[model samples]
Target: MRLALTFLRINVMNELQYRANFFLQVLESVVALATGLIVLSLIFAQTDALDGWTRPQLLAVLGVFTMVGGVIKFAIEPNMARIMSDIREGTFDYVLTKPVDSQLFVSVRQFRLWQLTDVIVGAAVVVWAVVTSDGSEQGSVTGGGVALGFFVSLFAGSLMIYCVWLILTTGAFWFVRMEMLEELFTGLYRAGQYPVGIYPGWLRAALTFLIPIGFAVTVPSEALTGRLTWSRLALAVGFVVLLMAVTRTVWSWGVRNYSGASA
Candidate 1:
């Protein structure tokens, strides 16, 4: 945690040198949020509910999507790009020689501090949606349990996403030229902006098990909107543990292989 904080502080200072970038980041965040809201409004105009989700519920889902997406852009994507570059350039040896865990070093070495604006905006949207939402359609989630569940699910979802990115980027050890691999994740994540239930069964299954878009966004949204099932929450937690173990094993193998090749 201390090392991560140091990296964050350094990143903040570096970003402070370019003050104008702050406004640019804010503008970009605003544009992205506005675009999402506009599309959502158009969808709701034709139908009162989306896959049985009311506007407020859908908006809550969007907020979770935005917040999680911001976290990816802020840390995972940038660091993953750096790892790819280092692998391609044969400079990853520096990381291998360090005493710290290679995966931890690679994950937090670079940060886009300004991208946190999206997180702020997304959190605000979630609070507003929760406050304004009528409980007519939702189940018995009238108290703070919903909020607690939402946050717990959100944390688990974030960890799952980080694990997924780690697994993907670890492929850089073998496919050094595959810098664009992260783009695949970015494209697939767009599908999570709405509830996964509206999609066909196959697609919904793919989202839940294959790419895990359902766990990342929809599960948390369901928690917030009082629609999350206990079984699904357990499944999400199980995925988190399983993915974390798998990613760690894969990362270790990648590091070992890279070390062998370098030696």
Candidate 2:
């Protein structure tokens, strides 16, 4: 833990060199939020509700989505990409020689401290649009519930996304160009902006199983909005375990495969 924090501190010190980039990051986050909110407004303008989610409820969900997506895209995803690149280019040899667990080393390698603004802004949105009002009677979540469920959802979503990335990038043995798939993952995360229930049956199933993205954003949002059920909670937990196992297996296999490829 101390070593990780030390590395994180080093990353921060390195990032301090480019303070201008942090301003650009803040600007980019606001622009993205405005675009998302505008689109949501336009959609709600056409319909009273989307998938049983009212305006405030939808706002809360978007808040959750933005926060999770920010963390994943800004730090988690980029670090995973760095891992895959290192693996393919022999830089990972440095990691292999280290005494630390390679996966842990790669997983938490980078810390883009500035991108945390998205989290703050997203939380603010949830606070303003959902938690501030007393709508307990309206079947929405209590503020306490939203806060608890938000962290739970964020944890589950981030773990699941990291595991998925591990599984995806671990395939770099034969497919050295798998970095392109991050583009697809980015698009899928964007799709999480809306309620997954609005998707078609097949699409929803794919999001739940094949990609398991809904858990990353929607299910947690559901919990925040008081729409979660035991079944969903169980599934989220189950998938987290399942994904962890699968990603580990794939990463191990990839290591062996890469060894063979190199030979």
Candidate 3:
């Protein structure tokens, strides 16, 4: 924790040097939020509810999506990108020489502090949606259950994403042209902007079991909207554990096979 904090502090201070980026990020966040709101409005205008989700409920999903995306951009994506670059450039040896675990070091090395704007904005939107909806059509979620379930599910979801991302990034060990991974992941992540229930059965299953955007965005939104069940939450946690194991196995294998640029 201390080492992670040290790295975070350094990253924060370094990003603080470029204050203008903050405003740009804020602008970008607002524009994206506005576009989402417009889409929600259009969808609601067509009908009263979408597949069972009300406007405010969908809003909560959007908020979770935004917040999760912000987290990915702020930490996971940047770090993963760095690892890919290091692997390609032969500089990953420097990371291997360090005393810390390679995965831990690479994971915490880079932080885009400005990307946090989306997190703050998304949280605000979620609070607003919760207040406005008041569990109407969503569920009767209230009291401590909402907070506890939301946070727990959110953490698990984010960690699951990180694990999957690392597993993909680990492909750098064998494949030199891995840049498409980022674009592909980003494209698939957009599916999280809405409730997975609206999709066809097969796509829903793919998102939940194959890709995990369903767990990442939908489960947390379900928690916030009082729709999450204890069993499903348990399923999410179990799935994250499974993904973690897979990620570790893949990373270790990759490292063992990697000959580095010098080799």
Candidate 4:
């Protein structure tokens, strides 16, 4: 924890040197949020709901999507991209020489401070959605229960995403130029802005099982909107554990295959 905090402090201090980036980040976040709202408005204008999800519920989904995207851009994506690049350039040998756990060290080495704007904005949107939504519409779910479930699921979902990303990035050991995977992941992640149920059965299965955006965005939204069931929550938790185990194994195997710059 101390090592991670020190790295975070360093990143914050370094990024603080360029204050203008903060404004640019805020602008980008606003534009993205505005575009999302416009699309949401058009969807609701045609019908009262989409696949049984009300406007506010869908708003919750959007908020979670934005928040998770912020997290990825802020920390996970930057670090993973750096890892892949370092691997490709054979500079990853330096990382292996460090005393700390390589995975933990790599994970904490990069952080985009300004990217947190989306996280704050998304949280505000989630609050607005929760407040505006009718109690009966939410099945009379209690705030405490929803909060507990939402937070737990959100943590689990984010960790699952991190695991999946690392597992994919580990492929850099053999496929050195895996940068294109980032664009592919982002394109797939956009689908999480809406309920997975609205997609075709095969697409839904792909999202739920293959990419995991369904669990990352939709599951947390379900908890917030009172649509999450205990069984589903358990399934998400179990999947996260499995993903973490798989990621660890993949990372270990990849590290073993790394020949380093000296080699």
Candidate 5:
């Protein structure tokens, strides 16, 4: 943990040198937030509720989506890119020789400090949604339980996402040209911006179990809105453990394969 924080501090200092990136990041976040709000406005204009989610509830979901997407863009996406590039350029040898765990080294080696604005914006959106949703009979965000659930679910969801990325990037050990794998995850993640309940049963199941964006975005938002069920919470916890185990197994296999080839 100390080493990871050291790397993060170094990355932040380095990124500070490129001041123009700050403005560009802010612009990008504003545009993304605006686009989401416009879409929400259009959808709510047509109907007052979506899959039993009121406007404020959906906004909370969007907030979770934005925050999770920011985290991925900030950490996971950059590292995945680096993993692919290292493989392609034969620089992975240097990573393997490092004293640190190779996966940890690769994952935290890069940071985009500006992307944190999305997290701040997303948190603000969630707070606003919760405050404005006070009068609602259903989907009301209240009490310590809902807040605690939101944070817990958010952490578990993030681990699930990290595992997914680890599994995807682990494939690069064999398939060197798997740079497009992140794009595939991005495409799937877009589906989580809205309520998963509106999708077909099969699609919902796929989002819940197959891809896990539903658990990452929807389930956490549901927690905030006081709609999360114990069964769903159990499922989320189960998925986190399952995916973490699978990712570790796959990463070990990839490392062994890489070591053998290098020797």
Candidate 6:
């Protein structure tokens, strides 16, 4: 934790030197949030609900999506993504020489501090949605439940994201052109913004079993809205543990396969 804080502070000091970038980040976040909220609002305008979900309920889910998505774009996605290029070009050896775990080092080596703007904006949207749609109107969620669900979902979502990246980048073990796989992951991650129930049954099932996104966004928000089932929460936790194990196994196999351009 200390190391993360130290890295965060250093990043803050560095960013302060370039104030212009801060405003640019805020502007970008505003545009992104506006576009997301507008489209959802327009869709709800056509109908009272989408798949048993009202406007505020869906809006809450959207807020979680943005918060998680921003974190990925800002750091997790960008850092882990460079793995393939680094391996192909022989630049990853430097990371091997460092004292930290190679996986952790690679996963969070950089901070796109600007993306925190999206996190702030997402929080605002979620709070407003909750307040505006109190009681059964928003499905009878308590403050305690929402807090608990937020952390639970954050952990599950982050774990699934890490696993997906690990598996995709691990492809560099056998092939050089792995960006295609990463592109596919990006598209699916975007689609995760909507409730899984919003999609067809097959696609929803795929997201739950194949990709593990079911635990990431939907289940977390469901907890906040008093809509989550105990069975689903258990399943989410179990899925996160299982996927983390699988990702570790694959990562070890990939490292063993790596020759590092030196016989």
Which RMSD values do the candidates have, in order?
A: 1.7, 2.3, 2.1, 2.1, 2.0, 2.8
Per-model TM values vs. the true structure: 0.95, 0.92, 0.95, 0.95, 0.94, 0.88
> What lDDT is obtained when candidate 5 is compared to the true structure?
0.86
Q: Candidate 3: where is the Cα deviation over 4 Å?
A: 136-142, 259-263
Model 6 ranges with Cα > 4 A deviation:
1-3, 9-18, 137-143, 260-263
* Pairs that clash in candidate 1: none
Off by over 4 Å in 5: 134-142, 261-263
lDDT of 2 by residue, 1-263 (tens): 87778878988898899999899989988998999899989998999888778888889878878888778865787787887788778897787788887777877788888888888888888777665533533334445765666677679878988888778878776777787878888887777888888899999888877676788778777776777665667668888988898888887777777668646
For model 1, residues 1-263, the per-residue Cα lDDT tens digits are 78899999999999999999999999999999999999989999999998789998889998999998888888878888899999999899899899998888888888999989989989989988889887643544436767767887888887888888788888888878886788899999999998899999999999887788889899889888888767777788898999988999999999988878556
Top-down lDDT ranking? 3, 4, 1, 5, 2, 6
Better of 1 and 5 by TM-score: 1
Better of 4 and 5 by lDDT: 4
Report residue 111 deviation for candidate 1 (angstroms).
1.2
RMSD of 2: 2.3
**lDDT tens digits by residue: candidate 6, 22-69:** 899999988988888899989988998888877887888888877877
| Superposed model 2: Cα runs more than 4 Å off | 132-146, 261-263
Better of 1 and 2 by TM-score: 1
Report residue 135 deviation for candidate 6 (angstroms): 3.3
lDDT of 4 by residue, 1-263 (tens): 89999999999999999999999999999999999999999999999989999899889989999999998899889899999989878789899998989888888888999999999989988999888886443433346778878888888888888888899999889889988989989999999999899999999999987888999999888888888877788899999999888888888888887855335
lDDT of 3 at 203: 100
Name the candidate, 3 or 4, with the larger lDDT value: 3
Cα lDDT of model 3 by residue, 1-263, tens digit: 78889999999999999999999999999999999999999999999899888888999999999999999999999999999999889899898899988888889999999999999999999999888885743444456878888998899989988998999899888895699999998999999999999999999999987788999999999998889877888899999998998898988888887854336
**Best candidate, lDDT-wise?**
3
